[model samples]
Target chain A: MEALYHVAPFTGYIYPNESVVPWTVLIVIYPYLTGLVAGAFTMSSLYQVFGMQRFKPVAHFAMLTSLCCMLIVPLPLLLHLGHAERALNPMITPHTTSAFAVFGYAAGFYVVLLLLENWFVFRPHIVQQAQQRKGLLGLFYRVLTLGSYDLSEKAMSYDRKWIFALAVVGIPGAHGLHGYVGFVFGSLKSREWWSSDLMPPIFLFSAIISGVSLLIVLYALSCKLRKVPIDLDCVKGMAYTLWGFMMFALMLEAVEFASLMYRGREGIEMILEYVKGPLVIPFWTVQLGICSLLPVLLLSFMIWQGTKGKTLIVGVVTCAMLVLVGVLMMRWNVVIGGQEISKTGKGLLTYHMPWVEQESGLTAAILLMAPFVLLAVAVRLFPPWEDGKAAH
Target chain B: MENKVEKLEEDGRRKFLRLFGAAIGGGGMAIAANSLLPEAAATETPAKAAIPAIPGYDWSQHHWAFGVDATKCIGCLRCVEACKVENNVAKDPNHFRTWVERYVTLEGEEKARIDSQQDPVNIAAAGAEGKYRFANRYKDAKVEKAFFVPKLCNHCTHPACVQVCPTGATYKTDDGVVVIDHTYCIGCQYCVQACPYGARFFNEEKRVTDKCTWCYHRITKGLNPACVEVCPVSARVFGDRNDKQSPISIFLRNNRVTVLKPESGNAPNVFYVGIDKEVG
Candidate 1:
């Protein structure tokens, strides 16, 4: 019979149980998905709440994207649990002190908020389809209408109020949920790498950049598929958002790293050693140099030169893709890297992620892609595109 | 001291009665109190009727503690084996309820070299995943200083594990032991990451976080933990700290003992003597 658990190989002295890393690749996916949800919601709110004209083209699409990502946000966590069925136990008998206990309630509230906001945003399209189409698809849209066929000026104004209200409330709700995800790691004093006051903000900023980057990529992809004229102003707006937030993310991360080194705490030697050796490629080269710095430099150059049209599109899209990879690497470094350094402060452990298993690389990859698949179906049904008319 | 014990028992009774009254009057209040005030949740006793009653064990009347004398330990591996057998812990080198560490300072070396039974060399020496033996790798090295430090869960007064358990499936008992309600645990392993000592592990078979409970079942029945009972050199000690004459009390009185990672603020109950600065 095979071993029930994958044992991490280590050097020096680690507690016997430390050989089996408690968290896995699935955890890396959890925060990444959450960040995308928050970022996408922020994009939608720019138009819905703040009334930013540049974001008008993608506002509804952004909401649909946020909802799709938010719906699948819990999958990685559920997959990681040993007792997935008992996942509700935390919500039912919450230990208030635990940062994790609040996750169920927060995620549930955000999911409901997303659904309500999505319903109001797509109501016009839903009403149109319900009146015109006939068949199973029509029945689905009618059921989705929730029996309110009122597209009157009064009803629309009321719906607009509700939409504005939900979007305003969602700004904090979405970001707070993601910031709390950072707190889950930062609050733990056990690991030197994770214990820092800067963690929450760092996570929030990185999340914003990642979400904006994802929007840039997705928006560009959708235009290509639909054969519609790409909205240059909308793309520029997202790029600016990504660039500004990326600066904060990079600075906060640098300060956090600098402080950790300056403190020269008990385990500094081991941390320094681990970073210099094992972290060279992942931390320095990929995440920092290529993914982070390259994108910032490219975006800065493009903005300075007043680049536009195809060049601007290519430049922004490339930077966004780099930022996306950079943020994923950030999540990996925080989650997996924190575990790699032994809690003993005297050793380091290497986690070998299995290619195929219950909570393996394959599962994580599939989960990362699952949201986009749902987004495709959601896009088809709701028709978030500004150019597309309802089926009537 | 006797007066103090009586006072504690009286306080315990009063608190229990208040909780019991609230429980009887409205289950919602107890649940509300539990979720709102973490101290109440931490100290809430397991319903007595739910457990199989021990003949005369009253958890409230006792407070347990453990002590380790590093100087006396022989690195025999007996305690490690005994703990696994007694607890039915996972029979593997990686999962241990209790294990011993060998810390050695070689000639002219500024730092000590450390390894435990889970080390690859030690596992190779033992020749089986279920067995444990420290390798004689240092036998050919220059003479210096060495000692074995036996380790287990501290069963801390402010256990980070219990504090971070999402479902309250793991908690500190009234008698001072931290245990998991295996059936209720979601096995997210947040507690495992929270532990500074790395004492907690996810039990694959049971699908819950497992750790050294200080052998709560056996200790409540007036028996020592398996590791303490089987230590040939009497390195491991266990007794109720509430008892003035208990072995742990005498050990505390006789030795200048310290806990692992004092800065962690865990207030670990596993007091140790003759451990070097590098032991943590």
Candidate 2:
């Protein structure tokens, strides 16, 4: 039952086991998706904690987006595992020293915190909606309330206090959630392509960038769908922040690469050959040229002297979409491109994503969209666009 | 009034003491609960129950290690064949518990030519007449030196694979061979990525990460590993490293030996004799 693909030809020596790359495109999606969760959560905090009143309309939407994405983050990981049932072992009996062991703890902590914060923010609204609805829908909202019927001013004030505390704690918790993913790649001393101290911070910054980009795109799409006017200030503010963070992330990556090149490390030549070989397309074209550079220019121009109406919205949306693709390309390069070069420095390994296989690229693409479907369901329940609807 | 105030102070001190005691007790219980979980989860397979003790030999008394004398290897690949038969490994060239590499370098050549006997499809195609053949792989007129270097899992004392396994699915045994508990493996492939020697592979058929176990099942029963037993030139050696009488110990003491990628600090149990610098 071998998947059909040409074994990538290799020159020089490669140990036999390395001929097939074990970590596939699904693993790439794991980190990329987790980054979005972290980044989007941070955007929500910009309004809740930092008091960025311009971001008010999108704050709840951003939090819901982050939660929806976070819920789906573990799916790709579970799908990639050879024995999915044993995934629970990490939570029950985690290997303390292993970097991956933190996945369970960090993800659990963040998910619970997000759920608590969501409850705090939406409790009063749920209580109100509960009274208006009937039958099963009313029962659903009632269950969600957990029998706390207090919609009083005092109860609302307490909820606000809790929300503030959770948001503050969540800032670093979000960083740890994504930063731990970076540590998994960075701690592997075996592969020279990933072994960098800069990987954690670099991942964190890119996460925030992609996250903000995703929010911008989603927000724009939502406005267009519901016939609501796009919040110009929100879009402009996010554009400026997105450009700044993307530049910082790009600089970090450049510095990391430059330092490695300057030192002429032992396995750097193999990676150089990889950059010349099959890696040229994703590494140079999609990740750097289209995704990174194009978005940077588009956003820079827009941020300097932003236009209003459809033109500004289109520009922001385009750049946001580009950055999203670019961030994902970066993840793909890190996970899959890193595996293309053999650790022995003698040759390259190749991978082709089979269309029909469960772990194939097609399946990964479908799995990536699952979160949006979940987000649709979440939107119905929480109504992230309520404020925007009222303004309209 | 003074007596009443003294009573109030006494009551506050008692409440404080009780809370402190409860906090310490709760903390102690949490620590105890944490330590006990991994112990319960570390249960070995029932296969260990069926393993018989070696006659008059205590398994705990000695440490095991492997050694390879590269100078003695003849590139016959009998060990590769034997290992597949013994372990029920797939017949595909991509799957191997042990494989042999041949390195050739002509005089005045700046680079060495290295080839491992993987890729069964090419091997079968070349030997269409039902006989194995390598068509003039070393046809250079100025051949300086050629040697066969057999490789397997080094079973390192400080194994990187074991260190990176998220669920502790891959672990080092007390007797020193690193083995994977296939049932428990999530197969995230982190262990495969961590291995510097590229000894680990995901078994496509079984859907689990597989590697050389140094024949733990056979060795514990006082039998040589399939590779060592089938080596016609005595190139592969396995024995108790603690015993001076063992062939591995004698070879290590007598020869200038090296392990692959010594800079990795894995402290491989497998030692190679007369190994070229080009070997991984």
DockQ of model 1 vs. true complex: 0.33
> Per-residue CA lDDT of candidate 1, range A18-37, in tens?
99998999999999999999
- Against the true two-chain complex, what DockQ does each candidate achieve? 0.33, 0.35
Tens-digit per-residue lDDT, B1-280, candidate 2: 9756755774574466346535533443343244224322323322243433557656566688888999899887788888888998766666678888878788999777777776443375456422222345656568898888998999887777877777777877666778888878887889999998889988766678999988877887778999999888899888998789898888888888889888876888899898887788
Residue pairs whose backbone atoms clash in candidate 2: none
Off by over 4 Å in 2: A1-9, A386-392, B1-57, B119-135
lDDT of 2 by residue, A158-264 (tens): 77877887788789888877887898898777888888899999899999999999999999888877788788988988988898899899999999888767877
Q: TM-score, chain A, per candidate?
A: 0.98, 0.96
lDDT of 1 by residue, B41-67 (tens): 444543333553678988889999999
lDDT values for all models = 0.88, 0.79
lDDT of 1 at B276: 97
Name the weakest run of 10 consecutive residues (lDDT summed) in model 1 chain A: A383-392
Local error of candidate 1 at residue A109 (angstroms): 0.1
Off by over 4 Å in 1: A1-3, A389-392, B1-52
True contacts kept of each: 0.73, 0.58
